[model samples]
Target: MMITLSLSACMLRQASLCIPGPSRTVLRGIHQSGARCSGHNRWSKIRHRKGAADSAKSTQFSKITNEIYLSLRPPASPDPALNPRLSAILAKAREVGYPKSNVDTAMNKALNPNEGAALQSITYEAVGPGGQVGMIIECLTDNSNRCVSRVKEQLNKYGGRMSPTAFLFERKGVIKLSLDPGTDRETAFDTLFEVAVEAGAEDVKVVLPTEDVHDQVGGFEVITPPSEVSTIASSISSPFKVIGVEVAYLASTPLRLPANEEDGAADELETGEGLGDVISEEVADKVFSLVEGLEDTGDVVKVWTNVAEV
Candidate 1:
């Protein structure tokens, strides 16, 4: 005699099992298979990639929101026209596709004096892996001890250590302006060069649009004295839109890295021994990881490195 047992559909679905009468053939088949289907594996990979992307976007949004709050602190006005720094931060938020609601929320928090404790700004200097790259991390937090501890932890975890790296950098104002579509690059550069110089700019260079800069066909980076940042940005005329303006700690002497082993080998050949200044790709990756980790920390607002490029 064959015995029969009935299982509810809900129970079977919850257990990811199929029961037909009293037969165990389906269970045996699944057990023999052992591994999941290819479709499931593909879906898992896609989910993981999406998770990483979402995490990056979240980090960016959080940083921008913090910036907005900081920009509205005492001595800074809620009106963009009165606060150039706030204006620049808002422009950055829009460029990154930050939601308008979030911006308004940050502003509201800033405007309320009792919303939270006053934020204090701090800067931490460190040397990255290989001791070739110097970094300056800027942060704003209500608790200095907590912020410092977190920064130190990230630095230690990523092969970096706190040290005096500030001497490697100089404070300067950086303004990035995008050229209007159909505008002649050369003409715009020439016009901006003259205008920037007249507005006390230190230097102006044309930056060709890249994958990272999708908003314009081309742009110009104007370096100025820290106090002249807003003056220069406001001085820009039509055909050029100011995209970013900030007082930044720029590397005084950028540390150049070899693009490949061949380049390093060539440098070593030129010198009697291995080039002490050049860092390997592995070390560069570690430095980049350290910077990313630092930026991900809640208090960290900006991270600058002496390394030219990665």
Candidate 2:
């Protein structure tokens, strides 16, 4: 009887996956499968993957909450509309699908630390495989020791080690903008570049993945001296909308990961891909896994690395 009921649930789940919107009759037929068959192993696999994804998403939201809370620290107003920096951070938080309630809770915590344990920012540096990858981990944690231990555990697990890698990177402001599709490419680029340069921006270039290219100039990134980031971002107007603006740790020297020449060639042949792409997808996946592990630690706020972003 127990097996029959379990099979019924699995059949219902499988039926739901097969049918975009399973009707009442289809659902009833799914229940009938329990009487004839008990084979539904795929349900366990599907459930496991869903559970893992939900857990990861939960951890990510917690980290974002810490960021929202940290952004609301005293001297900065709890009202995002009144504080430009906080407003920008809030916009970023919303872009990432952060809940408004969580944002409000974070603001409340910031306004009243006595309501909860106060959070503090901490930075840790680590060197990745071949000392080729350098990372500056920025964390907001109530318990510094716990954050340190978790960070160390992730690095050690991923064949990385903690060290003084901060010197390897320079702080800079990075702003991402969305360009208007109706505008001329050359004209838009020239105008935004001119505006950024005048505002002390060091460089400006499109930052979208070529593999996901569209007809229009979707967007671009602006790099500036750390202090000038906000000054330049605020100056960008009209055709270009500011999507993201934040201080970033840019590598002083280029990353020297072993080029996956063979994979690159294969990918290009298969999909017309180009060069200067990050270390191969496999290596990038591994690096991302390490990064995700660090982020999963509740204390970690943001993880930055020299490994090229995909």
Q: What clash count goes with each model?
A: 0, 0
Which of the numbered candidates is closest to the native, going by highest lDDT?
1
Kindly list the per-residue Cα lDDT of model 1 for residues 171-255, writing each as its tens digit.
9988877788899865676577567656777766545444223642656678888876776787886888776777799777655
How well does candidate 2 match the true structure, expressed as C-alpha RMSD? 17.4
Error of 2 at 27 (Å): 68
Whole-model Cα lDDT of every candidate shown, in order: 0.64, 0.58
- Of candidate 1, the 10-residue stretch with the lowest lDDT total is 1-10
- Tens digits of per-residue lDDT, candidate 2, 1-310, equal 0011232232232233221233322321321111111112221222233343224667768866776676566565666545445666777677668888888787777788876776788999987654556788888888898889999999889877888888878899878777776776457766775676567677655432222233124566777787666667778887986766667897665342332333332122112112132444445445556766776688877777764221
Model 2 spans with C-alpha error above 4 angstroms: 1-55, 73-85, 92-97, 209-217, 256-286
